[model samples]
Target: MPLNRTTHRPVSTNALGGLYVLGALLALGVVWFAEHWLKLAPCELCLWERRPWWVLLGIGIVTIVLPKRYARFGVFLGLLCLMTSIGLAVLHAGVEHKFWPSPAPECRAPAFHGGSFKDWMSAMPARPNKPCDSPDYLFGLPVSMTELGGLYAAAVFVVALVGSFRMGRSRR
Candidate 1:
């Protein structure tokens, strides 16, 4: 195979798969660390943001296992997953900024009607105690982690989209 003119190296499906896998793993690891070590619990939106990464990770692994001919399909799937992540991140960021209300009810403070305190507490979901609208900063950074995640996912989505097209053209 000829090397790509700009990169000066042969781009293969395995390489793209490895990049996707590594990127997803690293992102997940960072969130996990924050949640565990830093005691920063994820809200409902935060948990939703993680779904695409999990899917992307699985797609990357499957791509690695399949033959090179099937790699483009995996890349395409990864692109979709990344786009989903980006969209979710954007929504979360928007909620955090108070630009609009969150779609998830958990993001808002629970309304206590005429029920007793114990009844009201029991009615609430056990998980997602943290409201989705709250912004979780990254190590004191001005930007919230959700915004940063959107940016990162957008970058990866562009890279994967370009890489998939290049792979398709190169094969022809």
Candidate 2:
């Protein structure tokens, strides 16, 4: 296989673009399956974590459609999105492990003071917020979904970084 001249990696812009798209799809698919098929409830943090993947998906589609010269920029954008995802996942995992309190207000219990029972009930959200600390497992694995997401995001970030390096080198 032909290797990149500068980075010595065997990846091309097209492959990297496809990786971005596939990675996003796989992550989103797993979460969807866990939620719909496995009947796992996602907390506020979990929902927040999904946003980056959506962005990555859009970036991937654009990267694939754009010319090779412009694909490097898309890869860079994807790296940013992956970084966001990793940060959110780490935050969520910390909440699950009790390493620190969740930053999300929705993760906290609602406080009611001096309100009629009927009024409080009416003011409550239609669906009660899922507790952020509760760990959901897939296939009986010890790792929580949040941790898994972090690992996946980090891996993709590293790969994309290498691929982008190659892209930059090839331009020289």
Top candidate, metric lDDT? 2
Please, what are the lDDT tens digits per residue for candidate 1 over residues 14-51?
Answer: 77788789989988998999999999989889999999
Tens digits of per-residue lDDT, candidate 2, 1-172, equal: 9886763745667787888999999999999999998889899999999999999999999999989878778888999999999999989999999999999988888788877899889877788989999988877899988999999999999989988877777766
Please list the Cα RMSD from the true structure of every candidate, rounded to 1 decimal place: 3.4, 3.4
TM-score of each: 0.88, 0.90
Q: In candidate 1, what residue range of length 10 has the lowest lDDT sum?
A: 3-12
Candidate 2 Cα errors over 4 Å, as ranges: 1-10
**Most accurate candidate by TM-score:** 2
